[model samples]
Target: TAKASAPEGEDRGLSIVEVAKARMRDSVVENRGQPQTTRVTNDEEEDDAEDEDSGQDHGPLNEAELSRMAAMLSASALVVASAGGRRLRKLHVDLNRILDGKGNSGVFLQYVLSRLHGIERKSNTRLNPEADLSVLEPYEEALNLALIVAEWHDIVPQLQEQQDPYVLVSYLFNLAAEIGHANRVLRVKDMVSNVAEARWFLFWAAKRVLEQGLELLGLQSVEHM
Candidate 1:
């Protein structure tokens, strides 16, 4: 079901959720490519015995607790998304680079989310979507993020057509990167009165979009690194 072929004039295909579930189990999943919804299995998607490739050593996976709940969902999603149509011979990769805040990986995005969480916590001011957003200036980064969030309405059909999560993953990564740039210019928690509230609303709005996208990818954003 990984690579679905639709009929002419049709956009049917296996969904990213189906791909994730199938890939995780290394098993067959329902294919959405056909009108009847047939079952298809791609053996290539199944993981083989674990072994580090000679050229790349992932080193030891961290002793940090591992579970589906704590499974670095954001990072994993990014990795999967980055893979696109290709399959990695091994799932292992350098965690250090993936988790680096200076990199454009999912971990870096999570770090930004943690920062937003800290700001909200320290400010002790609740951010509401309904907050006065008029005070927010048209910062390029913020506006860019707004445009991305607005595209959420268009994402479902694209996902349905492409049946690939790289689209979603790419969006999340870009949004996170933009928020990082916006944070450099906007100080939300540090300001007082309407400025602070307006800024928090902006951050909160971005946070909302990020969380929604992550949820669609079967991933999450954390409060702390």
Candidate 2:
């Protein structure tokens, strides 16, 4: 039962109840619009928080961890060289050249083999007698070194044209295998049966010899000497 309060001049005045009904209608409209604004604000805050958390989770590795990882990789490479054996042979050839005429070849070769055998025994990873020919192959670095030695000593004539020394070394190993010197030939017919094993032995022996030779020359053996 709301009524107009007064008619002044030609205008009608609204009653208190009508004014209250109009205010209530405006309030409902304002409330419906306000929820969307509040929801949008909440959504934005959630998105920002997720972004911050993602950034925190993806931090870089620390310096100590990186150094330790590098050391472990180097150790693994050394172990792989020991297991494969070709690296040993490459070492042997290099050492023989360095020692050149100072030591008996037969004795040196024997010593190299024994050292390699000892490393294998320590590793507890038995080499398969009937494994694939290409199983646990020689390290590329050692093979390259052996090739370089051959080229430097003029063992092969075609190596003279090698522009990139690294490439030449790789080529020599491949060619040697193709031409049947993959196992080093002691004589025309007496080819070593297990070149990979011999190579590993040679590698360790060569490392020892080089270290000793450096000491003799009054220079410290740095890295692999």
Candidate 3:
């Protein structure tokens, strides 16, 4: 009986050991079958960080270029104004003497004053009220006298053909000043040169004054002036 009982106890001890081992194996297998929690690499994380930093580092040169461009434009404007003013002054003197004078003074003076007023109104531009009217002051009497002396029956037609009465008056005045006579015939070249010069000067002066005035008014210089 003792031997049989001892064998039974040994069998029971073996069965308990086997059951414990089987439980441990099942627990380990179940844990392994579920997904693994992957460990992230430090090199990949560092590379991602570096990429983010690089995205924020776009170059550094916007403000300097803008300042340079503004300065260049201002310098260009000054040069144009200085050169233009001098040219205009020369033309004004030449044209004024040619167009304003004694003999045809009344008619031409009326014409000049009327034109001046019209131009002033249209452009809203005012001549200096106190500016010296020396060149034009005697135009009325001078033009009338010129008309009397210029007894040519076709005077009106000839003068009108010149388009701008101011130009014709200038031409007549210059002729009178230089020649001391009005009705004298002129060579074609002399006539052409005189008219051409007067027109050039007049246009140049007008452009200069307009630009200067705009500058004074705190406006940008017009591109086409």
Candidate 4:
């Protein structure tokens, strides 16, 4: 298959989809029953972090790095159907942007799952559905955040009927943004009994929604970054 897709004289070795599938296999072992510090392990990770801390050069990723970028892109296309979209008349693949965690990229999507995994580890317990949702203050930011998680089911049949995974992709990115903002106000650990329990449950639900969404997209849905 890689041979069929490769341009003339370019021995790319592996297709993007193959590479992503390989990583999905790797993720099962990598995320087995634990929370972790999931940072990207590629060549650029160290430089990217250092560049963020100091104002240093963020050089371009080489062809080898671009293949890694393709893995994320291919997998994400199966979900959202569009980074630029799965079907395009003409598209330019930007290796830098796809690998960027802050942007609306697959890495950012994984980061959300990683944070939810951290919350679960911190709570050190499973979801208690009986947790008092009514206790959530009307003005609490998490109130809105939970509402988004609640929409997960509503969006599913649409994706199936329309045959477009991008809808779920949109939902997930939005969900991640809301949860990231709300976590500042909704402390999961070291809080009152009911509050901690309720927030933990909320996050647990969010984490599942994220994981399921990614799984539907045929991605690994990492426990860490």
Give me the candidate number with maximum TM-score.
Answer: 4
Ten-residue region with minimum lDDT total, candidate 1? 49-58
Worst 10 residues of 2 by lDDT: 51-60
How many clashing pairs per prediction, in order?
0, 6, 20, 3
- Candidate 3 C-alpha lDDT tens digits along 1-225: 001111143336554224323332332234223222442336444333322211111112133332332232232222222222322243221211212222433222222222322222223223343433243233453343334334333434664574433433433333333222211221111234343233223322333433333343243431200
| Highest-scoring model, lDDT | 4
lDDT of 4 by residue, 113-140 (tens): 7667666655455577899877677546
Taking all chains together, the TM-score of candidate 1 against the true structure is 0.59
lDDT of 1 by residue, 49-130 (tens): 1111111111222223122313453345335335433333333333334433356565555666666765665555676656
Which regions of candidate 4 are displaced past 4 Å? 1-90
Instruction: Give the whole-model CA lDDT for all candidates, comma-separated.
Output: 0.53, 0.31, 0.30, 0.59
Q: List where candidate 3 sits over 4 angstroms from the true fold.
A: 1-191
Residue pairs clashing, model 4: 38-225, 81-86, 82-85
Residue-level lDDT of model 2, residues 1-225, one tens digit each, is 112233233233654333323333333233222222222235344334322211111112233433332333222222222222332143322221212211322222222323333333333233434433342244454454354334423423443454322333343233323222322321111223354444434334333443333232233321200
